[model samples]
Target: MRIRSDGLAARSFDAETVVLDLEKSQYLTLNETGSLLYELLRQERTMDELVDAVVAEYNVDRVIAMRDVEAFVGSLREHGLLTGSDVLA
Candidate 1:
């Protein structure tokens, strides 16, 4: 799977919270954990890497992290914020 970083630029609202702003659109709010995941995605980490990172960083099981990451990616696609040539292939 492909991760899109074009729409997001990292910014800190406070010491604890991180926000992702979509291109010319409103900001997407993320908690500390979500922010960490988002930053990883910015580096174009593969699906497996993201799952591993999430599982390592959070106290969640591998299975749950995989499912949650898939769902989060799907949501990003649905929002028109994510685009990739491979997406249609």
Candidate 2:
């Protein structure tokens, strides 16, 4: 899915990503890998694409990449950072 831009703002610095959820008055800081995934989500990505990106970027095992990607996406969902019906698809 895509990032919700309505009341959210995001910035990247070095290998980190910072997201400001103006509607919620909350903010989140993401590490390097999280930043990569977040940037990808700016467009639209399926779960497999996310996992593959992690694997290609870090040379991690597919299983590990899948796990990490899921956790990252779940965290984004928990924080209400994602939009569109395909977010969890």
Candidate 3:
């Protein structure tokens, strides 16, 4: 599945990410790793693709990377930060 950052305003610093959901008037703060992941997913990315990138970049185990990426996406979805393929922006 692809995740698109539609309708959200995001800013990334060296160590953190600040995402603003203008529609909901809610925001999220993410650490260095989360910022990188979100930057990667700004376009369309598959689960494996995301995990692979993280593993390669951070030298983490594939299992751990996959789990972490999934959890991050889950939280974004929960907070309405991600726009799923089937959802309208």
Q: Candidate 2 lDDT, tens digit per residue, 1-89?
A: 76776898888999998999999999999999999998898897888888889999999999999888889888888999887654444
Q: What lDDT would each prediction earn against the true structure?
A: 0.64, 0.87, 0.78
Candidate 1 lDDT score relative to the true structure: 0.64
* Model 3 error, position 65 (Å): 0.6
Would you estimate the TM-scores of all the predictions? 0.68, 0.91, 0.84
Window of ten residues with lowest summed lDDT in model 2: 80-89
Worst 10 residues of 1 by lDDT: 80-89
Over 4 Å off, model 3: 1-5, 85-89
lDDT tens per residue, model 1, 1-89: 44465666657565334445556666566666666666666555566777788899887998899888777777656655554532311
Q: Order the candidates by TM-score, highest first — what do you get?
A: 2, 3, 1
Residue clash pairs of candidate 1: none
